[model samples]
Target chain A: MVIDQIHDLQQVYRKVVHSMSRPGSISNLNNITEKLEDDLPCNHAFFLCALTVLDAEVTFHVVASEEKKARLIEILSSYNMSRIAPVDEADFILLLQDAPEYQMNQALLECKTGNLHDPQQSATWIIESGLLSNISALSLSGPGINGTQQLQTGIQQDFWQRRNDKVKEYPLGIDLVFADFSSQIACIPRTTAVTITEVV
Target chain B: MIAKPHFAFFDEGSKKEIRRATLKAVAIPGYQVPFASREMPIARGWGTGGLQLTLSLIGRNDVLKVIDQGADESVNAVSIKKLVQHTTGVSVTEKTQEADIIQSRHRIPEKALKEDQILVLQVPNPEPLRKVDAREYMTKRMHAEDDYSGAWLLLFEQIMKFGRMSTGASHPVYVNGRYVMTPSPIPRFDNPKMHQSKGLILLGAGREKKIFAVPPYTSVESLAFDDYPFTVESFEGKACKLCGSTDVFLDEIIDPDTGERTHQCNDTSYCMEQLNSEEKVEVENSYV
Candidate 1:
């Protein structure tokens, strides 16, 4: 579907900003049709985020199987016009919840955790999920959080542990955007202290 | 939400670019994210950074307030207010409490900002290490390595030279215990206002092509040695002549006739509000 590039992107960018600044706050991405095109590998929320943030200036990496990666890249490129780069060099990484945990971890490990001076140089991971039930509950406390907030993230426990491990280095980890199928989104910046809650 | 021709004097493309960078800045709180800073009608050093942020975030419903050094009537402030108003047609206000977005040159408002408000600071040099090392590459490397000893050393040297730490403005601060950032050119007195502030503080350096943020409820500590603690610009016995407020940051004005220097609160609106109140409004001390 043809969307209003300027207005749609502006609305999407505001949602991304809102979600990123306030961790675990759900915001919906606008301008997406109810029907999903067969060619696209994921939901329109991911595409909306990719379109708003990815430009000719930045490169993106899609983490999936070989077949899925190529298709996702094609779809992202068609929508955003971002350069497709290697996993380590990419500014943005798109990972699906169904993607193999090992592959996801490998791609995330390869992704740049920018050095102390330019932490912003690191990659932003956009993990997409189909359902809220698939996500794990996490207790979050950090800068943007008021006191302590409990959030259910569309990320695997193993991967979440690995990601949290990477941030123990502090100021040198990737920021995350958790995008759900219906376009509901939340963020977990690197500075946030996240703990996996035990399921009762 | 009206489809204005160009939202806030910038085309959608420019606003999108700024929005992208701003999101990154928020995600990586206190990390300076480089962006393609466009040339504004105003000069580079005089708050183009803050203007870019203000324009980008401004919506039809936003209430904007612009301040230079502290006064809303300053040339820089008035010019910015006019430019934003001319473009977005957003409502403008002089009161700090009423503004949704505040674009400031140097000083933060005297009253505490609310959670919904945003404070945009026009940063001259976003790099706190600039005073220590002139080379940008080395400074970047230093920041990458978390080697902020140079910043501390610079402070030490200042104490050595002045017999005490005498950084007047643009003092270095540590945000989220990560990056050492210049809290714009606000006087030392205003530095404490940033610590776990309710409002988000965005710092933009147009010439430097960098933007950083201190998100709401974040810890922002001004760098200081334990013995020689971080201190604000002192005005212990001084009170504003107009408002009679002693806690607020004061500006000393000299009379040409008698050559007598008298103090007045730097924040004009807050001072006026205080003066107009039937009962005295006390600003709680936030000093370290």
Candidate 2:
């Protein structure tokens, strides 16, 4: 069973990398049941998404509750996880669909960015939301942008507002990505401008 | 060769971006140049930093040498060498002299590198004030503004208690009298090599996604207070058990059976080179 979990974890990681490089794309993970979807506490799946490798030095976070933290600690330890975080110190922020329940503020304060040691090493926020469109609609512009490209994600207004609050820090802010539960992702680097309009 | 992007390892378009940044790094000398970096084949902490720079600067005819702690045999060095060879079919070497570009992890070679030589250092963490100070935005502003009193105060505190600024590896230095820079984790002994040496010095951090440079013949002053001037650590009483050299960096390995520790040069190739040159040393091993 542990072997199966480990193997699935590996597949999830490759998917994340492929999507990031291609941008405006979706990665479908075949392993792991959909039943375990909501049960995933933090972005452990999201963490596993971009994580080609996990060591004692990289960090992760869980701010929802202490019980959640304890459970995460158990799961991460079983995977030989290193550099686990208090949500505040995480390099990557994974927001489950049900997140922002009671602890979003604490998670926000804990994730304030800056440190010349690694300016770009600042935390990245990834939220899993239901897709609202086929993605011929949204447009994104920023540093990674070659020009306006149709960005696709089904995230709502308030979701982006939460991201903007973090984004206002300018060069010192966190980058955001909204991925469908389908694994289709649109990245809004701190420099990216997101404008949602309906396709005529 | 590890089939790379459309043009060379990094696409011509990507190379253009890096080349523009390299120009800024050269123009500004020591300033950290922010770049839109891409993911490379190698892992970050290893030599990804230097690998990125090498990939960007790689031309068809260039000769490259990669060293970790001054030895080419180190696994990380071997891995990076393989990657560069894969992307660009340029000749790679173990010796520091024969190469046009050298990507080094720690120790600077004992031989003086030429002005034509380009040395790239792999940086794990580039900020010197990170552990002691808070705020990355402020640090960049301070570096741009040349506000270094805060860094000095921290060193002063260290001296008051420990009698020396206790930074080992990643030792901070003012590069070209312009920007405060971390010479990656190279030993302080190699710090002098950065001062107006023949080679252009570039630092890269793949995970952090930053690349900065110190131009040839530039001033790089390691931060130090007047009363407690900066000093480089030495092997002191220790000598390499293999080469019997006292001046080299020694790695201490504890013997499990006797609980005794044996010291040897952290540089495997350097030790072997010493044995080969001196008639006094002979063993069944490859040191011949």
Candidate 3:
């Protein structure tokens, strides 16, 4: 069934806004994800998020296996009409569950972190990961967070470290959104200061 | 007689562009993210920025409140409310507590906002450096280098001229301890309310085509010297004439007939809420 673009996207966008504003907060996208037909190239929640923000005005890049990347790009472009740019120039970069650690790190390093004058020009990384949990090794404290918030994600520790290195300078960094198989999503914006509390 | 407009008035593409800008604005607290600001049916300078944000974010179930300088019934507020209601058919309210999204100009609601609610402020000027330096390119470079000496110099000049910082509204603030931002033209009294606010606050400048945000729980500090501190408008020994409340922000009024000066609550809805509750308590006491 085709989702109502106006209503459904509005709901999804609100959740995205909530997650972005309050880092480490998890937003459940099952209401919209459950309505999607099975067998999409990307996660349902990720697809909904892409649809909510992507259009002809922007560009995106997908980081996945050769075949999956092509299919995901084709589907995203056809649906949203956003151009498929290179990794460094893409406004939105998608990291599928199948992406290797090395590629994820490379994408993290190569993605645009926007200059100080116009930091908002940076890319947003939308990753399809394993299950998302509230309690994890990562502790976040920053603009959106009231105090310190504990969050756990299936993403590798190296990626988080690299993200920290990329965003060491204020106002110049990429934002992250992680969507798991359970239709749960969370975001860590550039303003958030993330620290790995546990090795595991 | 007029055909119904698209959902939220702007086309889906325009909404998507604005949403993208808004997301980026939220991600980088207080950073002015530029976007293609569309023309609305209303005039540009008159709350179009906040109206665009309200129209883009309003959902079918959301309760919207529009206030111009704290008056719910002001011409700008009422006109914008009617436009949104006519376009989306959503519910509108005067009570700040009942609003899911509050689009405001010049003032924040007197009551504390909840975490779920969002405040969209219309900004006449988004650039805090515009007054210090007129060149956009030079100001961009200054911001890129973390050089806000010009802003400080402007404040220092104010002190030299008036013996006190004479900024009445649109006071500059340091957000997340990085970028200096103008919290819309909100009075200095409302500037403190933006610090670590429970609700998300988004400021949009439609004419300027800029958007910025202060996410919930963020640190928003007004710029001030250690000795010359930032102070809000004092209302000591003053109370709202209508509600008899002393804590809230009050507007000075002059009696037209007697030429006597009085102070009253600027937030009409908040003052009305106080009055209604007092009446209820009085009724219950009489019965007892």
Candidate 4:
């Protein structure tokens, strides 16, 4: 049984990871064991795909309440993992929903945005919500931006106040990966500049 | 479910980022370079960080050595050794003299490393300024200009309360006389080994998504005030029970059946070698 479960984990993980890396890439994860019932579907997928890649030696921050932490601990413990590290300490930050701007930015600033030579040292956020796509929200143009993609959402009020300030410190901000249970992924790297505008 | 771990446990892109960060770290000597750290087959607090660094730097010819608390038999050490051996099929040794690349969790070998050796430490926390500055952006700017006043202020605060700095482990050191780098969880006893070492020193935080380097033949000094200059810890006359050697780190092992506790050498391979060589000498003397 252990072997079978491990085998299933390996197969589904590859697809889930591919979906997370490449934007618009979709992959459905099938291993929804008894362990995943309590969390949001997106967070369940995050644990299946994310924790399969990170654990004991790789620190992560889960931005959920004590109830959620206990549930996560129970689920993660089944995999021989102990303790959920704090947000600042975690290498991966998992949020079961799109956070208010302050919380998101706070999490972002707490992440390690890599040093000079290798700018890829940024945090990976598994937001259990949507990375809204709209032209008036924020402007993004980079390797994954499709020559300039727009994120349309009511980006939190505080996030906009510091948007330009944060963007000016390019390649030193958080990189986000929003995953829906259906298995969709979107990312914004430090190199990509973002500008806020209202929807018409 | 995830696919089986890639060749060295990291995908090509992840390896590429670590490789690039490592190269830059090498270029700047003591500078910390950030990489898009990928989750390895290991857990976060264990040695995921060091494993990633080893994966990035390892090639076909490297001889790997992994140790936790200085012992080859430690559970975490055993786990890492298995991963490296399985992933790379490279030769692994517990002997400090034989290993070309040593990935360690919390201790350095008692034997002095040669110029060609590489010691990669697994750091739980990479930033020394993190406690003072909660904001990464602000700390980056401070490090950019070599501003560490906040760190001193904290240390001063420590002295005020305790009359001395009580920090014992994960002590900070300036690598290559430039960037201030953390030597992970190693005790002050091993911190001296970081200074002008014969081998390259690398630090990685797998969960923190950062990697840093300290080149060979460079300065790495623990931060200290003149009034309370740094001091190294010694075990005094305590010797490793397994090896009967006095120079290595010791571990307090409690017998499972009996609640009795005893001291043993943390470096199991070294201890065993010492025992073997001592027996050999006794045999030779008897023959003579």
Candidate 5:
């Protein structure tokens, strides 16, 4: 069954809002993801998120191998009519699975963290991961969190370190959206303070 | 019969644009995010911003509540609720606790909101520095540089003249210890409700073309001086004439015949609920 662009995307956007506001909370996008056509290079959740937010007004970039990157860009652009841009200029950047440390660092370093005047111009990185699970725990405390909440994910520690470094300056940092193959997603806006509690 | 408007009166593209800006607003806590505001059937400055947000966020499963000046049946609230229901066919309620999305102007609900609920406040001015600095570019720079002297000065002048901070509504608050934001034009009593709130609070300014947010559990402290602390409007010894409730915000009413003054709950739905519940208890006692 094909997804209803209006109805399905509305549901997806609300879930995104839910997870983004609460930071550590996980939202399931399976209902929308399942309706997507197969044979896509990226996770359905990432594509759905892009579709929900992207348009001709915005630009996006995909961090994948040369061939996969081209295909993802073509697919996203064709679907949403959004332009593809370099990492630094992109409004939304998608990091594909098994992205090497160097590429991750480059994307993080180059992505736009808007200046003081307009901090909302920063890029939102949508990272594809193995699974959204309790294999490793992250302690999150900040706006939106009541006291301290634990987030469990399979993402590597290095990425968290890079994220922390990038967000050291408040009001000028990139936001992150992590999605897994199981259609589980979570968001870590720049406001949340993330500390790796346990990595197993 | 008139043709049904595009599912919430906005095309998918417009919805996408608003959603993106809203996400950025949420991510940044209190920082204003600019977006293309669409022209609604209603005129500007008439709850259009909150209506736009409600239209963008509403789904088939959602229940919406609209309030103006704490009254559920006010002209502005009723018009907006009718438009939303006409376009989306979603349920509209007067009960705050039963609502999934509560779009309000000038007041927060007297009752506490749950984690799942969302509060959309209509904002006429999104910039906290607009009053201090007329130039938009300069205000942007001031925000970037963490220069808030003008904001404090505004309050200081009020204190110097009135012997107290006399901001009746739309009190400026420091959000997340980073950006200073206007908590809309909600009364001073409603300002504290934004702090550490369990429900997500999204503010939209259609005329200003800006959207901002206060995520759940976020710190929202009203600007105050060391010598003079922030205080809400005192309703001490004042109770609602209709419900006889003293804890809620009240609206003073003047009787034309005798020139008598009385107070009633500003939140009409809340007052009605209280009256009904009390009546129910009395009826049960009589039956026993």
Candidate 6:
């Protein structure tokens, strides 16, 4: 089920760019996952995002459970021979939906928040969510956003708060991508201010 | 014999690398993301950065527009347009409305860009603090610490030396209210068009090997003191000699025979369009 690397990667990269630029906008990356192995612990869209972003030059750290990490590394290595570094040193971090809140917080704190002069060197988090759209939502407002936008994600309030804390320093912080089961994606860059609105 | 150029002139790997960097740039507005800028037929300091961006993002269906100093026929612009056309065989257009991707050096199009259009600006030096601090690491530290006193100090000195701010081109702007970015070397007159622009603006510096962006609907305010206020290059009563259009930014032209100076619209294509339109139809074009 291997897809066309050059063309598929280009198409996926465009969708990812669209999502990242306009925070909270849903971009469909459906067919990008057509090539992933069937039995992987996580959805294929996340892997599609990984391959589109991470390459031989950039190292990635898998923050999921031990089983998922092993499988994730195996699949990722097939795409590139880049070594997996520790969470703090990794250029990209892949977190599964099942990853504990403590692990999420640890990754948030330990991941490289690039220094002011080289903020572009900061880590980007690609988090997997259970569903694409839900009743509960997260409010986002920042640079790319017109005013404010709201999108549904499976992430908890505590996680959003932790993310906010990490980004208080302005330019030196991690950017995030949320990929869901339906192959829909959303982003929250470090410059964005995020709030998990409670579902009433 | 010279070898034939590859599609878009760069290898697939290079294009992929650029696309990745571009996505990261858009994700984090105004923050300069370093990329492995490839050597093009053009020199580094010219429009190579914008060229790389245009090459990478260009699909077979894209209609490209290239401009230098507001003229599509400028040497730099023509060279780039020919290079891309030769490599990708993509249709090139002078009409701003027809272009999907517009690459330019030092000027934004006179017509307002739509949300679907992408603008790639060629930047000589991406660092706005280069004048204030020579060391890259020191400036990085300053930006990290949210310390931009040096930037303000530089502006203050300009005000002290002259009666008012004298920055004509390459004016510094605060993007998304986060990072102070140089909107390339575009005249201050074009700076206002970038504020919450409908189109996405990507700035690339080939020599510097950096890329950054101002996404659609984002705020881009030029750096100015509360008392001084941000001002664009003014052309109050001046009108283009050819089209008699008074609103657009005008370029001064010397009359060799009469030893006099007259003005013409800096944007050649827009000027041509104006001259072609019989009546001086005035809707107060939103661009100004």
Candidate with best DockQ: 5
> In model 1, which runs have C-alpha deviations exceeding 4 angstroms?
A1-3, A28-41, A64-72, A130-136, B1-5, B279-288
Lowest-sum lDDT 10-residue window in model 2 chain A: A13-22
Please rank every candidate by TM-score, starting with the best.
3, 5, 6, 1, 4, 2
Q: In DockQ, how does model 2 score against the reference complex?
A: 0.01
Query: Distance from true position, residue B266, model 2, in Å?
Result: 2.3
Per-residue lDDT of candidate 5, residues B182-257 (tens digit): 9999999999899999999999999888889999999999999888999999999889988899989999999999
Query: What tens-digit string does per-residue lDDT give for candidate 3 at B11-109?
Result: 999888889899999998888888888998988888888888888898999999999999999899999999999889999999998999999999999
Collision pairs in model 5: none
Q: Candidate 6, which segments miss by more than 4 Å at Cα? A: A31-41, A100-102, A133-136, B1-6, B276-288
Chain B TM-score, one value per candidate, order as shown: 0.94, 0.89, 0.98, 0.89, 0.98, 0.94
Worst 10 residues of 2 chain B by lDDT: B19-28
In terms of lDDT, model 3 sits at 0.91
The TM-score of predicted model 6 comes to 0.90
Ranking by DockQ: 5, 3, 1, 6, 4, 2
Kindly list the per-residue Cα lDDT of model 5 for residues A77-167, writing each as its tens digit.
8988899898999999889885676887899889999888889989998888777764438999899898988887677788889889999
Candidate 1 per-residue lDDT over residues A67-120, each given as its tens digit: 877788887787667888999999889887567777888886789988776677
Off by over 4 Å in 5: A134-136
lDDT of 2 at B74: 83
The model with the greater lDDT, 1 or 5, is: 5
DockQ of 6: 0.53
Say which prediction, candidate 2 or candidate 5, comes out ahead on TM-score: 5
lDDT of 6 at B155: 92
Which has the higher lDDT value, candidate number 2 or candidate number 3?
3
In candidate 3, position A31 carries an lDDT of 78
